[model samples]
Target chain A: MPQVTLTVNGKSHTVEVEGRTLLVELLREKLGLTGTHVGCDTSQCGACTVHLNGTSVKSCTTLALQADGGVVTTIEGLAAADGTLHPMQEAFREHHALQCGFCTPGMVMSAVDLVNSNPQGLSESDIRHGLEGNLCRCTGYHNIVKAVAAAWPVMHGKETVAAE
Target chain B: MYDFAYEKPTALAAAVASLAGDMDAKALAGGQTFIPVLKQRLNKPTTVVDLAALGLVGITVTADSVTIGAMTTHGEVALSAAVQKAIPALANLASMIGDWQVRHRGTIGGSLANNDPSACYPSAVLALGATIVTDRRSIAADDYFQGMFTTALEQGEIITKVIFPIPQKAAYQKFRNPASRYAMVGVFVAKTAAGVRVAVTGAAQGGVFRHAAFEAALSANFSPDAIAGIATSADDLNSDIHASAEYRAHLIGVMAKRAVAGT
Candidate 1:
């Protein structure tokens, strides 16, 4: 077994894992951070999307040993200590972006990274294209696209949400 | 996926040695493609050599060429200002790969090494006449790719970098298969100092290949109209569930023209 250390969601943990153990498995099975779902088990589904060292990657394809000593931010790490949702999460909720909510975690995780990387502001098509890896079986992506647009303004501190 | 021992070698030599010492070992790059193969139990290596710690991620640009490190991710390439300025078409092609998540982890060297028949990078390499620098030697792009999911790379030979000559004008056009998004018929056309080169992927059975007729036509005159009258033969093209060989051949013509017009 390979002993891997990960700083996940701002917490550090050293655990033993098999060489074939995936990063998503480490997060969900070992650390109990089940917010990162394994929708397809393959890399195609973005349900296992997470931030590895400030960039979004599909955790299902990332090996545990490959991510050793790296910092990871999962869907669980997005909110504040007081339980305030991230602007993307808030927008998803406010605009009714999700229906079954199965894809929300990865969708929101990928969306935040998209907004963070593109400070110039994302258009509707950009959001749709940006979220191509994340498949939402419900809501038809209309509201999800709307939520990403609405959140970008607030995320960049150009506009305030929740009457801030 | 079968359980295997993993080694992350900090030095390139050590990484190569680790792989060389074991016949059942395989080198792992970003593993965007390999992992999926492993999940399906398609490949079962006894040992996996992790290449992340070898410090093989960077992009360098000169007046004529851009050299990208082997471990450089597609996300990094797509975002690189130098790459964007030097070869915007290459950057654009990288941006259109698998997806945002895949781009973050998929490496150019990995894609080239795997040499999947329908992969996008090989078309660029073939069209641009790039050089694949290995741990031991530099191989020309023309001689690097052999066939589907195959390359000239030896068992333990690692790709250190890829050197691509910046083209005067270049563009890639891909008709994506709606579901897998793999290129149904992708064409990359480049007008370099040497001459015009057109490489087509996804449609060919023998992997990416240069379109000599289009190249000759476009070299005489660089425009969609120049290659409009020419037709590609469907004899050696791939025909699977997604597209027929005839359809792929037709798409090659349309895509080649589009690539020329865009460039």
Candidate 2:
């Protein structure tokens, strides 16, 4: 086993893993951070999404060893140290953005990344098109769009209305 | 995934040497397609060479062409100001590939190396008359692609970059598969100083290919009306659940018209 050092959330973790170990497997099996769910083994489903070096990437497709020098942020790290829900999480709850919630963690993580990077504004069509990579069987996408729009201000410190 | 030794080479020489040392070694690029297949045990290799550390990551624009490094992510290429200015069609094609996550991780080299029949990158190469640069040699687009999941790359050869000439005008149109987002039918058309080239993906049984008849028609008359009577036979086209060969043939014409009309 190759020893690998990676900064997850805010702490550093050193673990021995097979060189071929995937980042998703390391997060779920080794670190016990099961919030990032694996929907499709292929990179098709954005369910295994996480922020690697500040950009959203599907964890299953990213090898653990490749992230050796990179900092990774999972859903577990989204909350405040005092256990306060992130604004996106709060918005999702308020808007009923999830059904089974299997894809919520990844969805919220990706949404936060999207809104943070986009400062101009995101319309309903932009949110839907931006989150097209994520699939949700239960939510008909009405609330997911609402959650993203509602959380945009909290995440970006800006207020905007979604044009109906 | 099958157990295999993995090597992340920091240099191109190291990557090639690692592959040359192991007969059953495969270069791992984006891992968008290859990784899933590896996990499914469809491909079992003794060693895997990871190219992330090689520093082959940039988009360079020259006087008449653009050079994209092998390890350049689709997102980088799509959002690159240089690429957008020089060849907006390429940027548009990159943006439409798979989805955000896929674009974030998927590299052009990996997509070309894997050579999935439904992939989008190959059509760009064929249409723009790009050159596939390897550590060993440079290959023109016409000689690079062989068939499905095949390329002209020899063992241990690493693709360094792909050089695409700036086109007069070009556009790519794709009908996406709703589930996987693979192209149900993708067409790339480019008008260059040499001539007009038309390449189609997802609709072909072998892989991405140019349409000589359509190219000839466009070369004669650079208008949609020129290809009004041209017919794409279904002899070697793909026929699957997404689209029948006949339907794909019709799409070829429709997409060609749209591409020419800049719609």
lDDT of 2 by residue, B94-157 (tens): 9888878888889999999888999999999999999999998999999999998889989888
Scored by TM-score, the top model is 1
Identify the candidate with maximal DockQ.
Answer: 1
For candidate 2, write residues A32-133 as lDDT tens digits. 999999997777768999999998888998888878878999999999999988889988988999999999988998898889878888999989988988
For residues B112-181, could you state the per-residue lDDT of candidate 1 as single tens digits? Answer: 9998888899999999999999999999999998988889999899999999999999999999977557
Model 2: lDDT equals: 0.89
**DockQ for each numbered candidate:** 0.87, 0.72
Assess candidate 1 and give its TM-score to the true structure.
0.99
Model 1 Cα lDDT, one tens digit per residue, A84-135: 9999999999999999988899999999999999998798899999999899
Q: How far does residue A65 in candidate 1 sit from its true spot (Å)?
A: 0.9
Q: Give me the displacement of residue A154 in model 1, in angstroms.
A: 1.1
Specify the highest-lDDT model's number. 1
lDDT, candidate 2, at A142? 96
Question: Which residue runs of candidate 2 sit more than 4 Å off their true CA positions?
Answer: A159-164
